[model samples]
Target: MTQARLRVYILSLFLIATGIAVSTFSAFSLAPLTFQVMGVYWLFSLLYYHLRINSRRGSTSVEYGINYNVSLILFTGPFGLYLFEAVYRLIGYLYKKKTKTDEPGEGVQTFYNVGSFVIQGTAAYYVYQWLIPWFEGNLVAFWVLLFLLVTVTAVVSDLFLLGVFSLLGDIRTRADVAAFLKERSILDMAKTAFSNGLLLLFLEQRNWTAIIGLFVLNYLVSQSYLVKAQSAQDKHERNKYEHMAYTDFLTGLHNRAYMELKMKELEKTKEAIGIVVADIDKFKSINDTYNHSVGDRVIQHFAAALKAKAGTDDILARSGGEEFTMFLRGRSFESCLALVEELRQQIESDAVEAEFQDQTSRIPYTASFGLYFFTEQEEVPIEKGYIYADQLLLESKQLGRNRITVSPGQQHESSLSTS
Candidate 1:
């Protein structure tokens, strides 16, 4: 399934599961309410994902944290946080959609930003203490004060180290987060800071349950983002490898494998295909006389030339050493020859002077082409087309080797067979 479909399905399952868990917890006591805060955060995250899909330019990974903050606030008293978020999005739809997309986050995400959690966590602690029928007033107030100090201090230290580490290039985006925050990497520094601070805060207030729950929640939260980042990194690496496999490293042109794939596609289409086979004329002579280094320069120069000459629909590839091929989309044989000839003349008249290996030299070079055209129903086999083009290349070689040779295929036979 597509990533989008999979994401939607997973989110749907999470929402259902969290809903059931919250309902069960609600039946026994208020313990599930804290997790419900997390659930609400997830719901907002889902909404943000949809919003991002609708606005490509404005999508940001940081939106997830923004949703978490809003969800925490909603649980405090204003019960319609989700509805409020929906209305806010509608009001600023155009504005938010115009924002630029960026990597997950930059620098510590701000002290004020994380400070909101302190406020919410303090409120949650007081509410929990007050809910007990036999709870005394002094105990409840002390617990509230204790939660404020520990949660605030722990989170502050995490953000402080996060800011410092970011300057040292230890920060990570969601797409590449695993490197810095492995099983016990630099990322743990932030977690360790938070844990120590929380220990002090809860110890002061003696709220053991809140301490345990907060620690567990923080672990879950960080790991969720880390896992997501690891998956994205894996995907990016796979795509990079696949691209390297099919691309010419030096010239950045499609390589032989891509050419084979194109041929397969053309076979399926049964459409007319134009092939221009190119060889760097006297390429080995240049390599011997001027050294292989300058010879590489000539190859790159001509590759750039071929790339520029190709039309928008053309596929230009480095088929082999000192050889190239261009498949021009829906073109007649004569025009393909004309283009190849134009490229020849362009290189013949062009002089490329460069300083290489501490020696300045003017390298003059030229190329030859053997053109072939085949409609889908041609009697000639695909491999034979290559042979025919090679023969024409020999003809170009005979005629001083710097021009285009139209194919020797019989037009009537081609028409009869393809028709």
Candidate 2:
């Protein structure tokens, strides 16, 4: 059976067993007046259930303590709690279906939720019954003991059920489970559990002032959790947008826009910067011969080779189609020339496979390089440096591609080198 169907079957059996236990053991001491009061409160609970606060780990939602409150008061025993929860969840499922198709599916999620409530209620009700008699006259001690016992039992039961479901579901790996737990803040659950415990105690005392204060406090807590969730979501979106803005989707390198910004920033530093502009020698021919997909693979392969050769602090970017630019900060002009020559040799040595008509061919590629160096002391603008480098790049192609050409502007110190 599928996980959902298995869960449904198990939950049906558990509910049936709990129902039998409740019917058999309970005194059912409450009058018709209590039942009537519970029915009215169930309506309030339905609204509260809809106004759920999501757990920080984002694994699930809680009804801002209202579910536990109903379990504590309306249901005097486990059987009553189970029956009330069953009805509550059934109506909730129906209401959700009528409103949105985006909600989690009805089977496993509902089964797990209702099953957890049953377990928590069963354990808590029996424990409270066993302990209440021990401190009957000392109301403060009774409330304190009840709060600690019920909260611990209920929260533990809920977490145990959640762990079981996670193990059985998509979050089975240890890393995924850890991340899931981290996302669903255990502390958040503890806070909610503790707050609900206090609320239940206040309600039992029937102190209207304390009850109202507790409700307000719980509402603020829930709101604070939601606000933090929203803030995190906003930060995630901002980071996503920034990455897209600066990254090249095709090669996963920094794009030209980012490189331009870097260039401007580096200009202010007044450090000597070596610029190496490289272009694939026959990229258009490759794309035309092997198709664009294989061409893309070649581009990715080339990018990998470039990244392998670059230093940790080196700035490399895809300036445009089949073209890339590298800036070597604080490197001499000769070092930059040697770096470009190394890249040329690397590209020529590496071979990529391209498949065509059920036949695969190993293709070796080469790129032409144009090198220039500039510093803040130089009166020449960087734009003019790029233009001069492009002129030498054209000369390299004219002299036969797969070679490096350096500009002669700095030839007073050292002559232009070709590789």
Candidate 3:
């Protein structure tokens, strides 16, 4: 085994042994009522297992199981708590195993979870018992003590789990630790404590019906909220992935895939559109002269300038390395030609400042443009318009670069030079 896995196993074994010793020696009362409560809690936990909400980091999930476990620890002590945890966690481990849904090191994780629960529960039980004498006959002090007990339980549980993760090399830096703690909801912890406090109150009054009814009502409300939360989370994830797919990482412009999709959509409408294919002149020389980093800055600089000239209704994309495509909708052919010419002039004037080695260098660059103006009267494909524009762009390059070659309509072409 790897050293990290070995260390995790050793720790798990140590915790398991220590937990067993503590449970065996701990003084806990297990009445018939305790068994009844345990059975009901287990049943509800099993029913609601799939409904749990995972933390933002997905390291842990939130469930009312903790609230029930807290009540068990207080009501029947560490022994009862251990019994409930052991059986519940074992069933959970087996279910994951059977379904082939267990993550790597699932066995170690199960042991760790059981041991951590027992250790935390046993510590909480002793602390509560120790404080009971001081808070006797004082209702407010007792409530405060109970809340403190919950806090103690949470702190011990988090510390134990974090220590294990550290050993497993999951948390190597202060930022990782911060992220771990950040994903844990303080409000969820407060809710767990409050629920446990209510459960304890109900248990003390021997109101079994109230306990069941309150838990059921809380479960229903939580389920509704969880559904909405899960939906929003799914939507946010979808949008995030879509953005990654469609956006160019270098220039932050729409990528070729998005441009093609837009083209298909526009093709259906058969709208009069202007397509422009632009290429940064001598981009290879820019990278060779400075570095790829400077080249990237140049590309970004060019994209920003092009985006500035594009209308809100127009679509612009980085179709290839040092190549861009623009779709200008709702514009006359003359206006489209004028826009491209203006953009070509702007690019010629602008310079990209880049630091190379220890010196600052201002790099002057220019781009060639190929514009195809498509009218509604033409019986041609949008894809063919892009091809024609690309051909015109090559012709512009051949004509000495820094020029806009325009295909007004059909096969008729004209070249405008800025030599």
Candidate 4:
């Protein structure tokens, strides 16, 4: 590991050790009422253990048990609080398989989860214990201030621990850290904190009816989170599958199906358009000499060159093996030749290679272009343009390859030397 990673691991170890020590110390010095409060806390913790609002992107989660945890820290010490939280998480680790299934290294993640919660639990304990005794007359104001202070401490502690753990993973910058927090929601934090404070208030008044109401309210929030997360995930999956259906998996370009859709859309427009069909010359020779892998690399290289030459509005697509097509909008027959010649020159000068047994050799290749241009006045079908381009492309291959053959009796021999 590098120095930074070493430091992160060291910090993790330190948090774990500190959490254990504080929990042990607090256990030895627990008040007589601590156990009674802890028993009730455990009941709520167990009930809310599975009620976590998992991130839509599946990065982190927010549990509805925050109010329960905060209340526990205020009544009992951090020792019993951390111990209960750890047990709850351990149960989750064993039975809960949703997030952990996709995530590797569950053992280390368990340590971080317990350690971070313990650290935050201890901080909340200190802040609440130190401040609550200071207020004299107005107990309502005192409770509000104490609740705000403890919640703020919890939020900051949570962010710090999460930021540290994120650094240990793939998150590398302040912007990433901020985005992480923003995506999770600061409003959720405030809402949970307020709920916990209300629970504490009701507990002081021995209002069992209000406590039950809070339970229902918190459960509803958790349900809403689950519904939102699942809906977002479903939408994301739908979009992903749609993209896959229309994309060329080999070269990461548009597939023929998508190109046909674009052609149909362009057919309705009255603007002039040019269709060019280009095929790699002697592609089978490379596949025969080397392997299919090397041929794939050559195709990917040519696709990148093609993308570079095409405009943002131009539609480029892979039309099966060794063949590609482009639809250029608002371009005449002459403009089509200029674009093809520049792209052909780029392909000629492109140095693409594939490695075999630590040896690399350039996969030199060329392509022949056949283009057809149509004007707004012309009622020529798009299918005719494709047929003519393919026919002219075959003619170029027959009569000395690596040349441009345009419709309307226009043929231009490439100035660039053939590969």
Candidate 5:
């Protein structure tokens, strides 16, 4: 448990102790429900905070994440004290997803929400249960008015909270932590929960059956959210694994291993393949002058631009530093060569205005490519496919830095459809 939760637990214990002490000397019978709700809040709040850390991972939608956690806010007990903890967790989560850093005071609204809970819940507790009899001529009328007031308070507070939170519609699940965390100006989760919790006290106290129902409902819904999150994370992890193995991380392009993997996949399918290997022109000179960041940008910008020129079916992976390759999925040797030539021209002509968030100057960069096309007359293994592409890239570099070379293999049987 975090320090904050410990504080909440200690405070709750104090309240329970106070209530018990008060009941010992008076006719007032303390509601066991308050203690039960407080205990539940402590437990769930821990879980909610832990999940908040795990869910801020790559590409998870912020709206979906918030919605995913909403069931907890709805069914939780005690004027939604736990709901406020969820909000604090959410604040941290929003910060990580958007601004990419957890800046100080990023979740001030969350703390304020907790404060609101203390004021409102404490006030309502004293007013409805203690002060009502003093204001009424008849005790029955006092009880009725007290119930009505708490009910209205709960209803109005929930409506106002929903109204206020609706303004967070613009938030996206991007890496902008500071801005997202700071955007909320109104009621936070804690206050909302505390205010809403008033209604639960009027409703019949939940027994084992009700507890079971709440558990099952929350579990099913929360588990569904977890499953979706897990699925998205699984997909991302697979993609990331593939990228790590096959991509040049600095440039975000295919690495040497990627070329080998795709080649093997193609050879297994017995499809015609085009291998175009690319190299940055004057890459060493750029590295020498502007250092690695600019050099890194040159590679990244080139890869991004080249990737823009290719079809979705095409394979473009950075094979090594300043060297890259492309695999055209279902094209003939001749057509694939032609495609590489087009790509080579695009790389030469394209000027990347590589901007630095830290600097004002822009740098220009370019690269060359070699093309090799092959068919299934001979079985091509991963190693052979990669060596062939490497040779072609070397050939292109020897001819000139900014160029493409084609290695024509057996043309595969082409499919035709005429209606």
Candidate 6:
């Protein structure tokens, strides 16, 4: 392991040892009621473990078992809470091992969680004990104190996690700290505190039925929220993957696959369309002269220029390296020719900046284009038009690069009807 990982393991061990020492040295006693509460808490913890709701940000999660844990702290004090955490966390570790669900460093994580929970829970219990005398008679004050206790517990846990993350080099700057804090939801904290407050109130009244009913309702609500959140997460992942699949990694333009799909969709429509195939003039020479990186920048620059002039209904794609295609819809042959000519002129004037060996240079370049425009009355197949466009692009290059070649030359335009 690296030195950083070794240090983290050492820290985890130190905290675990500290927790065990404190729990052992402090006063401890057990009663029938303690056993009953421990049994119920274990059942709830196991259930929640299987149904944990992951937060939208970071590695934090929401589980109703937290309310029960707070209740345990209130009823049985530090010693009891520590005992429960030690056994429960060990069982969790073993279960993960058996199911082969444990990730790397899971053992260390389990120990760290046990130590942190003991420290946070024990501190909260002591604070509650110390402060109860000041608000013993006032129910409102007591409820507020419980809320504050929950807040303190949360703060302590956050601090512990932050410290560990800093040591792990996951957080290194002010911005990192700010982002970490941003991921923590104030509303979720409020909900946890409110639930803990209710649990403490029900415990004070010795209302077992109310406590059971509250937990049941909380579980159902949490499950419903989990389902909705999971559905939304799945949809987001699907869309992200779909976008990646259809996009060119270098230019961020639609790939050939997307262009093919668009063509198939347009084949069913009667729209007047223009198919254009364009290629960077001497792109291979550019790469050989500078480097592939400069060539990539040139391609990106060209794609951006085309994207800038494209209409909302127009389709532009990077069909392959140094080559692109466009589908201009609802345009007459003359309009399509004008647009292609304008694009050719713009590309000829534009230069891409390149850096090499601590030197910057503006690399001037040009592209050749071939456009084939057809009205709906002509009933030309899009596939055939694309082939013709590609052939014309080659013709432009052979006739001397950096120009636009179009079908039905200007001289023959009057012979054919326009869209």
Top TM-score prediction, candidate number: 6
Pairs of residues at least 3 apart in sequence or in different chains that clash in candidate 4? none
Per-candidate TM-scores read: 0.51, 0.73, 0.74, 0.72, 0.54, 0.87
Ranking by TM-score: 6, 3, 2, 4, 5, 1
Tell me the deviation in Å of residue 252 in model 3: 4.0
**lDDT for position 361 in model 1:** 85
Worst 10 residues of 4 by lDDT: 55-64
Q: Candidate 2 — what's its lDDT?
A: 0.67
For residues 41-121, what per-residue lDDT tens digits would candidate 5 score against the true structure? 454444444343231223221221221112222233233433344444565558556866654433543443444343334
List pairs with backbone clashes in candidate 1.
Answer: 150-201
How many clashing pairs in candidate 6? 0
Best by lDDT: 3
What's the CA error at residue 223 for candidate 6, in Å?
A: 2.5
lDDT of 3 by residue, 5-109 (tens): 655654765467466647564465556887888888888777767766544233433223435667778887766777777788789889989999877767666
lDDT of each: 0.56, 0.67, 0.80, 0.72, 0.54, 0.77
lDDT score, candidate 4, position 101: 52
Query: Candidate 6: deviation at residue 47, Å?
Result: 1.0
Collision pairs in model 3: none
For model 3 the local lDDT of residue 116 reads 74
Which residue runs does candidate 3 get wrong by more than 4 Å? 1-26, 53-67, 133-144, 249-251, 260-275, 282-314, 327-365, 371-392, 405-419
Residue ranges of candidate 1 with Cα displaced over 4 Å: 1-205, 379-383, 409-419
Model 2 C-alpha lDDT per residue in residues 1-419, reported as the tens digit of each score:
55555566556646654665467445554666446435644665675664575443344343334445433432455555565666777887877788774355554556656666766666666666677678677957755665555565556554654565564564566786566445544555555556655656655566657755665665566667667877998999999999899999999999999988887777677778777788888889988888898888888888887888778888889987988888787677777777777888888878888786688878778888777787668777666666776777777788788887776656323232333
Model 3 error, position 73 (Å): 0.6
Q: Whole-model lDDT for model 1 versus the true structure?
A: 0.56
lDDT of 1 by residue, 105-142 (tens): 32122222233233333344344446434433565554
